[model samples]
Target chain A: MDKLLLLGDEALAQGALDAGLSGAYGYPGTPSTEIFEYVQHSKEAARRNVHRTWSANEKTAMEEALGMSYTGKRALVTMKHVGLNVAADPFMNSGITGANGGLIVAVADDPSMHSSQNEQDSRHYGRFALVPVFEPSNQQEAYNMTFDAFALSEKYKTPVIMRLVTRLSHSRAGIVRTKYLNENEIKLPDNPNQFMLLPAFARVKYKNLIEKQELLEKESENSKYNEYHDGKDRSLGIITCGLGYNYVKENHVESKCEYPILKICQYPLPRKLIQKIIDECDEILVVEDGMPVIEEWLRGYLDNCLKIKGRMDGTLPRCGELDPAKLRTALGLEPYPIKEVPTIVKGRPPELCKGCPHRDTYYALNEAMKEYGPGHVFSDIGCYTLGFLPPFNAINSCVDMGASISMAVGAADAGLFPSIAVIGDSTFGHSGMTPLLDAVNSKANIVAFILDNGIVAMTGMQDSAVTGRVEDICMGIGVEKEHIHVINPLKGHHEENVKIIKNEINYNGVSVIIPRRPCIHIAAKLRKQK
Target chain B: MKKNIILAGVGGQGILSIATIIGYAVVKVDIYLKQAEAHGMSQRGGAVESHLRISDKEIHSDLVPHGRSDMIISLEPMESLRYFPYLKPDGWLITNITPFVNIPNYPEMKHLLKEIKAHKNSIAIDGDAIAKEIGSPRSMNMVILGASAPFLGIPFNMLEDSIRAVFGRKGEDIVQKNLDALNRGRDFAEEYIKK
Candidate 1:
């Protein structure tokens, strides 16, 4: 009964380990990256022979996990919400293929775009995939539901989606030790018909999925994961799901009689539970972290569901993670005001570190583009995006993982002045290679900046494709040997680096500017370990 | 009664290790437990927070409310103040009073200790000095965490166990040093804190 202090993401990984998962595959993304990283580092997980690795990207990760599940081994795929978009091809198709083992897809949504490009809800993906989705209300439930999700996956022959928001993924809570199950044997499909995805087979599987919807709803209605806590308050009924439910229950723990509550952790729109809340209370308030999917459904299900109020009704903001203050306001509790202070924490936005190599590289790029004017820089995702802050403010665009190179090419072809693309080593591998190839073949005038930090730097220094060899990749992408410039991004030689950037910017053909330096954090970690 | 407290800070500031010590030690007096942390983007010096919700009864909500937290333990002054809306008016705030230069806004930083000192029951400790005295500035978060121990109602040995649990695997020498840092902060708080 020893308690281990766990991050919400780590707890989910440990929960998968405790639940007897055979393997975990994922691509690193904010809020969800630690799930696989923790699994990779855990002695218990390793002792049980759990397979853990960072896949090429989210799609490869999802497919690899699906392949493991096909062999009748419990496999968990972890990814940030947009990672679901990358994996959507395999995700939407997996429902038709079906799973042999317990397959759980844990999607961590970053509402308010904290560290992500989008604040998408993966629950919609779950609904689209026709798989039952499980959202934990807290860390313990994150553990329990992860364990239960594996069972549900096995029982229904469908991959279960476990959705987490930034609050749920990053938060910590006390979790009781549960019985651990270690299953190493792989159970292959008994019938080949399950793997065959011919149109006939897919149609049959699709129909089977349709028939299983009732079972999913039944499982949700009868789940130990989802519950109806009878409270004292019947007038202002509160129906909350996921972490939003936790906020409601804790703040109004004493007001049980006044507020009847239906707490949902598992999904497929538990209509029966919604009905119970509607029938019991005069005014119902539906609280959820993101989107009004359930609340929207309940309104139609039970004659507008007793004057429904929630995010849709402006009872809660339709965006961002929901906390107790927002919940308290929805329930008519006294609001807590933030103390008015003259000078609090300084509003200094994040920038490259003092000795960061990216700093000099960005400085060079900015100087080279002085004649080109602004909006000519298309940047990729990484620590280099911090260049958009103060002193530098060099990057004009940062859309997604590897949009910089392609966007820059299009802009250059459209006759933009000195269009340059700056992406990190990790991001270049993630999705930059294809665009770089396109630029090479089309003979575009865009200059691509590959900031090689020898690691993923932004997502905790995990390994990347170009981690060890950036020079070779640029050369392979058909950059002229003379134009493929590799320079250390340190201070005192910022002017020389800027001169190199100017030469490349002036080049009317494809060019690659390689800024070489170790990330400050990574260098320190290496030094400490040594 | 059980009170759930959340301590948040930037990565290199030792937030996780400090939370571990508090989690291990608090269990001895209260039915305390701490969850394992999984920070994805802490590598880029991103903001990180750990939830330590301890209570007399079992706690279901792992996250502390925006304004209902009993205490906000911070290693970096800015990180502590960033989550200031989460702290209750009557709650305690303990932070390291070091001035980290704002690199982008170079040569300019508004001091936080003066404003924090004027707030209710807030105490700023020389966590860096205590940690250095214990042979590591990396242990500064533990010092600030230790400053909140007595206020948290957790026994000394309980914290010692958490300290031991986290650093136990690293080495015995590190465990002793971090524990020393924790005690040094505790002693400083005991002598200087008015509340």
Candidate 2:
């Protein structure tokens, strides 16, 4: 077997490819973005003509994957934790519909909010959807679990959720490749209405889903990924989940910890093994990333019969990602005294790239809106979100994808004249379109600036769905043709761009201004390639 | 044997390339390796660091505990000092003297150098100048890697071989230029140690 060094995201991608993935759909996001990228760049994937492309957003990606699964093909959909929120509608409902082939939803969580708005755990979502979840401890396990997750999905006829944190998703390690499996032949669902969720059908499907929980727990208890190890000392029982197991094992290198240990990678609690640990040891410590879902459950509502220690007990810090240093302190070991970073080393926060088109656009917007004051411009996510920092300080609000346009419209309805929305090309396609339609239909007074930078510049330059179609899309949504203005965002065109923005601001109905240019980084890479 | 290294530099400066070469060498020798990298927004000219842990035995954490790192290999002077607390009391700090002046408030070069020299164990080399002299200005990262190679615990030749393997896809010219850059940097460090 050949070993290849891979990030956890790449390992999952490779695993899916080797496990006969027919299609992969996703939106570009930190930690989870690389899964689809690896498949898109894989020679094997291209040879197999696998459906690998960026979807409009996570919801569309989830629905597309479900469609593929309905055709009896294995499909993988990935997104960051917050992205799951966008896809939650289809994701939660998919449980009632059940899967036709195999469906795996790989959601990479940011426990410490690294490159994220929040650190909401995805494990809770797994429990909410009544789905079995697999959380790998290392790169090898990430690969192996992904390979097995499809079979688990097909067996239970439910989408399997594979949860990963920032550390696991971005960290690299060596993993051995497994024998490749061929693509599944296309077939239809056994029952015609398996996917139909009319209230009557949904009731029966929901009941069937409820009944599968027992078997899911049984499979989890017998899973090779979940194990119980006995130790000579019965003082402390250690229950580790996912990457928590790695940190624990890292501490006890020579002969493993002298405590009864249960390592859980497959979820739905694995009660019997956990009961064994609780029954044997004098005290129990639960180590898990994100929320203490397992820890809270083990304690139960009022049955505090045994002592349980974890995040809730201040044994570990309540927030942030876990590491060896924190674990050492939790185990009562004195930490080594490290020197402090000198005050001279100033903070270097991320900023807009020099010569970035967004900088110019923000500069012009800042100049144009000086009279209206600072509270009017609403923004969406992307590299342009950095406009809120430094000299620009241009955007007033940035609260999720597509919210800018709708929020600006609502503000305008409340008599804030010249209300403006600044959004990115990729984001405009994601959730921006529907909101724009709503504004147009209601005839809301708002000037929506679509920062059209050709590529999805923030997440390593993936293709944007609205590359050359921004203006046409505005027109299709019933915005007046004359009010849809495209201006080059550059120093040479500064005055002209500012004037255009001002003109749209004064427009009585929904207007759009597109500040268009290629992202400097992507442009340079293209120039070098040529 | 255990080696805990902090690879520091401004984002988009190819710090990961140096880590990749060393990681390849570590893997070829059957050593355990774990690297925690700063990704996403930080890659856009923000401060970036990679905590790389290598050991003959299994390693526990992806992060290097504060004050326990064996070496700080930096691509810029200020970025090197940024991880000052992580460097063990007697640990080495090898950095490129070049200043990446992307920000307006960058400290004066003379004052920065003096602050760096105040450390008990530190080496500052003009890696950009050496890379340019060797006709591979883009290989400044390789030069910094070479200057710190002697203190890496791994055999120097192993790094050279790893460099070749990592860059082999780009053809022979690139491979040779990087090799020369590495040698030039290592030679400079060897002489500085003697002095």
Candidate 3:
């Protein structure tokens, strides 16, 4: 097998393809976006005619993956940590329905908020739904475990989640190719009620889920992803989970670590192994990235007054991503003498590109809403979220994917005058359409500015679901004909656009003023393609 | 041999191209290599960095630890200063003298130049000027790559081959311009070190 240098995301994508993946689904999300992109660009996937298409939203993506799994063809659905929240409803129920085919939800969590709003560990979601979760410590394991996760999912007829963090997802390493397995033939569920979730059937499925927990625990104990390395030191037994193993190993790069180590990259706690390590060592230091999930569990599960250490006991930080330096301090290793960055280094925050349409849109909105005062323009997740930053503090809120329109609807219902929502064209297609329908149904007094930049400019310009369909989606959602307006967002059209924005805000009953312009990068891309 | 190098530049400045070329060169020698990158939100003209590790033995950490990096290669002057703490006390700092002045509070150029020059082992070459002289201003990244190529511990021909392999698809004219850019940059660095 030829060794190819690939990012961790690419490794997982290649692993899935080699393991007989029939379809790959995901909405574009940082750290997770590249997974789908790799499959889309792969010659082998293209040759095999794998179902590789970007979904409109996370929820829609999750359902389509489930549908593929229903046909007994292996499917992999991917998303970032926050995107999981959008897909939570379908994700929670997939556990009950189970999988006829191998189903793996590849979730990349951003710890330390590198490119995310929060560092939510998806393992909690895995545990909540009573499904198996696999967290890979390195790129090779990211590949190896993803390949194994499919068979594991099909073995128990359950959906499995393979979780990796920001560092691992974006990091690059060499991956050895595995044998290519043929894609599964289309085969439906054996049992008739396998997918039926009516009250009576749901109760039975829920019971089965509960009964499988012990077996899952045993599977974790035997999982090659989870290992126990005996160390000479008995004073401390270190429990390193997923990326934590890398951080801990970073400290012992030259020599082997002395502490007894339990490296866990799989779920269900692996009770027997935990017991063995705890019995041998004086105190247990649980070093897992993201939240102190393992530490919290070990503390509550074991009543044995064992001194537990981790983010909980301040051995490591409570939040943010873990790195080699953080582990060095906790391991009581001597710190590397470091030079402090010179004071002359100024902060250079990420900003809108020079010719970005969002800049012109924010400039006009800031002007139009000047008399209405600040804190009324509710915005959502996108490049437009940067409007909250300096020089263009036009947006107020950035809670989730499509919360801008809905939050504006709620605030306007509570009598906030001149309520406005600032959402990107791609975001509107994701979760903004339903909330827009709510505005139309309630006759809410609000103006939603759908900044149509022709594509999903953020996350490296993926195809936007509503690129040219923004106006039609609003029309279908019952938006008034006169209330909808589309205008160019440019320096030359600034006055005309501002007038349209002001008029819409005054119209009061659900007006959508769209500032339509192709993103600067996309325009450049089109020219190159041409 | 082991090398932990931090490549720093503004997003869209093509620091990744430099990393990619080096990545290919390291792979040519059949060595273990890992690169950690900052993507998504940070790429919007933000201060961006990449950690690249190449070793003969098995590599553990994807990230380079503080004060352990063997060299710092940057395409921007201020960006080169931004990651100075990552450079070892005896490490080399090879950076472009060009200023990508995107921020309002960009330090005074003379002061920034002084900070980079004050480093015991450093090379600040005007890569943009060299690329322009070579009649290919767009090849400035390759110029920076060439100037830092000596410190990379890879054979010169390997990087030249890497440049050819990476840019070969673009056509022979573009390839020749880049090769010229690389040679011009390496020439400038060699002359500066002698002074």
Candidate 4:
């Protein structure tokens, strides 16, 4: 077998493609974005006619994958940890409905809030949904687990969640290719009411799901990924999960730790292996990536006879990702001397690109809003979010994907005159359109600026849904044709754009001002291609 | 043998490309390689770093431990000193003397170079100038990679082969220019060491 250097996300993508994945659906997000991008660019996937397309959002992506599973085709849907929150309704119910074919929900988590609003753990979602979870420690394991995730999903008739954190997802390592599996044939469920999920069927399905827990735990206990290594010393036991195992092994380079170790990659606690370590060692230490999930479970309400040390006891820091340095401190190893950064080194925060249209848009918008006030503009996510930093301190708020429009509407309702909302074209399609319709219905006095960059622009320039059609969508949504204005956002047009913005701001009804330009990065890439 | 390196530069400065080229070369020889990259938000002109670990045996952590990095191969002088804490006391610092002054408060270039040169084991070269002199300004990353090639524990020919493989798709002209840039950088470093 040939080996290929691949990121953990790429390995998962290749593994799933080799495992007969029929469709890969996802929205562009950091860490998880490369999974879908890999499939989209794979010649093998294109040759095999595999479905690869970006969904409107995570919720739609999840539902579409479920639909594919219903048709007896293996499906893979990916999203970041927070994206699971948007798809929670379908995700939580998918376990009850069960699956006719294998389904893998791959969620990449950011432990230290890198490129995310929060560092929420995805393992909790796996537990909440009562679905088996696979958290691979390395690229090879990520590939192997994804190849096996489908079988596990089909065997248990449930959607499996493969949880990956930023370090594992973004890092690259060599992985040997595995034997490919053919695509699944279209086969319907034997039970007619399997997916109905009516009140009558819900009870029976819920009961069946509960009954399957014991078998799931049995699978976890016997899983090859969950290994219990015996050691001579029994003073302290170590339970490492996912990347935590790597940090632990990194500390013990020349020799293995004397403590009995239970390395967990499969979920459902793997109670038997955990108990074996607890019984052998006097004290247990739980090391996990995101939260103290297993640690909290091991230290339930009742006090145990054996002393347990983990995030709770401050043996490890309760928050942030685990690193080799942090693990060494936790294990009572000698600390390395810290080097101090020179005072001359200034902070270099991310800023708008040199030729970014957002800079021009912000400059014009700031000029327009000078008379009104500083706190009137609400922004949304994207490259334009960088406008909140440095010289162009233009935006007042940036909460979630499409909060700008809705927040502006709420403020307008509370009598804030000339409430301004700024959003990107991609974000408007993701979650901004419905709120714009709400403002139209309520006749709120707000000016929504859709920064039409003709691409996603933030997550490496994926196609924007609202590109070339922002005006049609706004007009169809009942915004008066006269109120919707499109202006070029450039240095030459700054004064004109500011004038147009001020005009829209003075309008009483819902008005949308679109400053249209292709993202400078995408423009440069296109020029290179040319 | 293990080589733990920190590749640092401002975002879009092509440090990841150097990592990729080394990664391709390392895997061809059946060596274990793990590279942890900075992606997403931090990539928009902010300072970025990647931890590249190559070992004959399996690697444990994707990240290199604090003060355990064998070398810091940087594309910018200021970015090179940023990861001083991660470099072992004996570790080499190979950096391009050019400054990527994206921020308004970027320190004076002479002062930055002085701070970098204060280190006991440091090699600062004008990689962009060398690449431009070789008729390919975009090969600055290749120049830095070549300058650090001696310290990488891999053979120079292997690094050249990796460069050929990575840029093979860009045509022979590109591959030849980058190879020229690499050799120029290697010559500069060898001369500096002899001095």
Kindly list the per-residue Cα lDDT of model 1 for residues B20-74, writing each as its tens digit: 5666566445474544343543434556667677776756555666677788787
* Model no. 4, DockQ: 0.81
List, residue by residue over B1-195, the lDDT tens digit for candidate 4: 999999999999999989988998888887999999988999999999999999999999999999899999999988898898889888999999988888888899888988888888889999999999988999999999889987889989988898899999999999999899889888888989999
The DockQ-based CAPRI class assigned to model 1 is acceptable
- Per-residue lDDT of model 4, residues A89-158, tens digit only: 9999998998778999999999997788888898998889898999999999989998788999998899
Top lDDT prediction, candidate number: 4
Model 2 C-alpha lDDT per residue in residues B30-67, reported as the tens digit of each score: 88888888778878889999999899877766678777
Candidate 2 Cα outliers beyond 4 Å, as residue runs: A254-256, A301-306, A525-530, B108-111
Every candidate's DockQ is: 0.40, 0.67, 0.77, 0.81
True contacts kept of 2: 0.63
* Model 4 lDDT, residue A517, Cα: 83
lDDT of 3 by residue, A289-351 (tens): 898888888888554565889998789999998888889899998888776777888999999
The pairs that clash in candidate 3 are none
Better structure of 2 and 4 per DockQ: 4
Ranking by DockQ: 4, 3, 2, 1
Candidates sorted by TM-score, best first: 3, 4, 2, 1
User: A1-530 in candidate 1: lDDT tens per residue?
Assistant: 77755667887888998888889999888889878899999998778778886787888889999999999999999999998998999999987777889999999998767788778788888889898999987777788888789988888889899998887787665566688887747778888789788898889889999999999999999988778887676777788888777787767666553577788889887778878878888888888887777777667655544478888768899878676677778878877766543344545444566788888887777777887688888998888888887789899898988899999989988998688899998889878888998999999998899999888777787887767677788788787789898887877778888888888888898889888878887787778889
Q: What is the lDDT of residue A161 in candidate 2?
A: 97
Q: Compare the candidates by DockQ and give the number of the best one.
A: 4
Off by over 4 Å in 1: A300-306, A336-338, A524-530, B4-11, B27-51, B76-84, B103-114, B130-135, B168-176, B193-195
How many clashing residue pairs, candidate 1?
22
